[model samples]
Target: MLKLMKLPTAWGLRNASPFNLKAEALLTMSGQAYESIEALPNKGPKGKLPALIDGEQVIGDSSLIQRHLEDKYEARFDDGLSEVELADAVAYRRMAEEWLYFINLWVRWIECPTITRDAFFSGIPWPLRGLVFGRLQKDVKRTLHGQGLGRHTREEIYGFGEEALAAIAARIGSGPFFFGDTPRSVDAALYPQLLNVAEAPYDTPLREAARKHAVLTDYVRRCDQTIFAAREDLPNVA
Candidate 1:
């Protein structure tokens, strides 16, 4: 059995971090027997959650995890996709994980700091909570700055988010999944990020932007119902 190190579940999501959720979704959809162990980012070799432990080997990063599943376990997430279709799927997944991920960070940590602090940091006690959240927010800002999104105005950030959502909606269109009726690895990558943006408790312009796209919301709902249909016992943050 594989052991997946994950962050705590929160905001009605399998995991508050989209990457963590993505890894879990891939495992679930692949029909793999795995154990989700609640652990911190530092616990993993890469200092990130969603690390998959297969015997003595610990695979870090969601994409790497997918590769491991495919190479080692013969899991076929892109079973029927043509070369061009696979390329397209990869492009969309990169956009979501690289670009939109920063936009989400801005929304959660910068735009709605109170919500994030209260939900994730309140357990630290009063003064320490303030200190810890302050440090974490600073680190996030530095990361975003290095990524170039933090330098933009808040409106510009949210505008980028809206555009990303629109693109995702267009790609998904009327299909049940990114490619068609069959769920692919792209769906696993896309679903959790969409859920984080559309369903998280925080009310930011980014969330509102995600909501405006009916296609995106519907896609999220379907993924939530279908991909995670078997793991209904997963806990949620109250």
Candidate 2:
């Protein structure tokens, strides 16, 4: 049996981090028998969550986990996609992970800090919560700054997010999935992040921007019902 170490669920989603959801999506899509355990990033080899424990081997990062599944387990998430479609999928996945992710970080941690801080650090004792949360916020801001999106104004950042959502909506346009009717690896990469922005309990412009795209919200439901449905049966998911 395989074990997945991931962060706790939040906002009615499988995991707080979209990357964790991506890794689990890959596992479920691969039809592997696995159990999920709640864990912090430090437990992973690369100081990240969603580490797959296969016997003595610990696989870190979702992309590497996908490779492990493909090579070792013969799982093919994009079996039917054409080369062009595959390339498009890669581009969209990069947009979601790299570009839109920083926008989300700014909105959640900087714009709506109180709500996010409460949600993530509520378990910590009051005396140390401020200290711990301050450090976490600083680290996240530093990461966003390094990504360059944090350098932009809030309005500009939200504008970028709206543009990204509009682009995704234009591409999808009443689709059963990203590329086609089939759910591919890119769907695993994308669905969770979009869902987090659209459904998470925040009222920031980023969430508003995501809400503007009816196609995307519908797509999230479609993925939840089809691609991610199997995950609900997993033991101790939260």
Candidate 3:
């Protein structure tokens, strides 16, 4: 059996960070079965999660993992998308990966403690919520500095996130997936970022706005049911 190293036990619906969710969803959609191992990069692999070990091959990072899976499974769409379509996909994926980071940072630093505490504690059934929260706070701070958003105020981050999301929504148009009919690479990539923002423990005004968006909310629900169901069943990480 192919084994996926990740924070979630299975590939689908795990409460993983966005990147992990994307990788798992892709795997699930491909009809591949993988065993998952909980990874704590901060404690073990230099602060990474969702690393995959398949036999003697060890891979880390979500983008690389997706590429690896695509190569091995050959399950990506082959219909020739126009250059414009391809470009739009790449652009959306980048925006999703980049802007969503700030959303997560905002949630961890500002919103998580308030809305997520009860949900997180009640879900975990473990006594390590404090430790998890502490680590998440530290990680978010580090990530913010790494992304050059450390100096920006929360208001700035929120504003930027709103703009980014609006841009994504505009690109989505009336397509069920990012690419209209069928899901493409970009759909797989961006969906997780949106999912993270919408489902995070924080229910801030920004998150609530995302939730209110019909298309975005529907997309998250579909991914949760189809791609991430396995992860959702696991004990909450924190």
Q: Each model's RMSD to truth, in Å?
A: 2.1, 1.4, 4.7
Rank candidates, lDDT, best first. 1, 2, 3
lDDT of 2 by residue, 1-238 (tens): 9999888877777676899989888988899879888898899999987899999999999999999999999999988778898889989999998888778878888888988878888999987998998898999899988889889987899899999989888888878798778788998989888988998888988888888888999998898678767766665544
The TM-score obtained by model 1 is 0.95
- lDDT, candidate 1, 91-157, per-residue tens: 9999999999889988889988999988887679989899989998999999999999999997888
TM-score of 3: 0.79
Q: What is the lDDT, from 0 to 100, of the residue 4 in candidate 1?
A: 88
Once fitted onto the true fold, the runs of candidate 1 whose alpha carbons sit more than 4 angstroms away are: 232-238
Clashing pairs for predicted structure model 2, backbone only: none
Listed per model in order, the count of residue pairs whose N, CA or C atoms clash below 3 Å is 0, 0, 11
Q: 206, model 2: CA deviation in Å?
A: 1.3
lDDT of 2 at 73: 99
* Candidate 2 runs further than 4 Å off: 232-234
